[model samples]
Target: MTPLNRKKERLDGLAASTAAPAAGQAGGVDVMDPVDPVGEAGAVRDAEGVSLLASAWRRLRRNPMFIIGAVLVALFILVAVFAPLLAPHAPDDRPLIGQISASTNPIPKAQDGFPLGGDEKGRDLLSRLIYGSRQTLIVGVLATLGGLAGGVTLGTLAGAFGGWVDSVVMRVVDVLLSLPSILLAITIASLASQPSQWTVIVAIAIVQVPVFARLLRGSMLAQRSSDHVLAARSLGVKRSAIVFRHMLPNSLGPVFVQSTLALSVSIIEAAALSFLGLGNPDDSKAEWGQMLGAAQNLFDLYPHIAFWPAACIVVVSLGFTLMGESMREALDPKSRR
Candidate 1:
């Protein structure tokens, strides 16, 4: 045989030998070769990613602080939503011809249907607190959402379209930043005169917009230069589409964190404005701030008058703050490390 034929015969023999079944087996399958080293490594990496996410979820579930915060927030929301049904008495009902701050007052009893005791006006303190939850939650949630919307829009525009647009937008932000937030809110509230709930919402939104805008701008600036953004650009994607669809989704982590923190601050601001006699001027019976304002008078005579309302405000704000911190840690890739 020629040298080439001899080489081919040897290769065929080697393949047949490799495919042969073990001795004593009539017809057994051939043993498969081990997977490629690179492919095996990739499979291990994919498995590790899934395991990491599961471990993170398990750790979060085991965290006592996060659990307590979540429970408190849930309870507060339930009470707020069901206040009218759960309250033992009408929030605005008062005793006949008696001041709420009277020291030697009749002790309220279930027989009298005043289970949680009465305020200086003889209105049920527990009832008012329950009702006040509705106002606090409404103002807090709405104002925070408004700020997030306005801030994210302006920040995304400024960051995506640098140069004169960015300069002008950032300059406007700086001007707002120079003003004291509370003072600016007070001025806006006063100018509106006997501000309604919507008016208070607008004022709080204005104060918060600058914060969101600044944070989003920073995030956008960083993301705009990333490899994926450049890759999208190279694929002939429109600037607006790339920014909104690709970059914005990646930038939402910081925006979510800021929104959570800002919600707590907005609630506090709503309370302050109401306490100063600026919010919901028409609806005296519909606000926690207004209740706090009323309670200031009976502070010395009936401290409980102010105590319950003030405590509610503090607890609600703290709940948001704690939730914000926990969410920030969870959503941030750096924090996971």
Candidate 2:
């Protein structure tokens, strides 16, 4: 071979030899593929990077508390949704006076196809409870939404725009926070020109607004200084886009979890307003609290009437609480499960 050919061959061999060990090193580690921290970090992040909602749902399904809550809530929802179908009797229908003897008293127990028997007004207790679930759920859910809508608007503006706006908003929030929620609700509801369902919902919603507003504001403030938000700012994204599209969406996990909890509170508040004669006073409507209030006088003679509604309120409230607590746990980054 010519000297040039030999030199070319030698160079090729040298290059192959240098590349071989790097490709298949003794320790099984790749010398050619040195660790790139940024790339590795990306991988690690992706590995942990399921969407928040999806991750929360996964955890929720597995959590016993969530399962229990979901089941109770679902059952209640079904009962509420299918109230008309499920109620065997008209909620306001009274039993035949002669059919049920006077000796049995106004409230009967576990007879005449009425499993839970009759209320003071002789309406089927089970039927009333079933129908009442509908009104309770409507009030609870609608009131919570009202609060959430108002609160989100106030909180987003206050947190996203800081300084004087935030100061004014937070001060108002503080004032609201200082008062007892129930007491404030009572005051507001009582002040209404006519005590009705709307007043009760408005009162409960007004009480909840400060709670959600403070929560969202704090969450937003914390996220506003975060790396992603700063990056969005650097990219010349509009403040509105960064706040609504980025910061708001990211900070909503806590709000959603709290909203579930707030539903239970709203239910209780609405019920209390009704009990206090500030809500629907129509005895025919079959509201749990109203039923209880009507039965209060007869408690000594027929405690069973109060028992059913009270139990319902407790169980439904507990269900929402468990759901909220489970959500809080699932959303927390530090939680192993």
Which candidate has the top score in lDDT? 2
Query: Tens digits of per-residue lDDT for model 1 on 150-219?
Result: 9998999898998999999999999998999899888888888557888889899999999999999999
Q: Summing lDDT over every window of 10 consecutive residues in candidate 1, give the lowest-scoring window.
A: 106-115
lDDT of 2 by residue, 8-108 (tens): 99999999978876767777965553475644565533365688779888988889989999899999999999999999998889863334556656566
lDDT of 2 at 114: 88
Off by over 4 Å in 2: 1-49, 99-104
Tell me the TM-score of each prediction against the true structure. Answer: 0.79, 0.84
Worst 10 residues of 2 by lDDT: 38-47
Cα deviation of 40 in candidate 1 (Å)?
17
Q: What is the lDDT, from 0 to 100, of the residue 261 in candidate 1?
A: 85
* Model 2 Cα shift for residue 122 (angstroms): 1.7
Residue 50 error, candidate 2, Å: 3.1
For all predictions, the C-alpha RMSD in Å is 8.6, 8.6
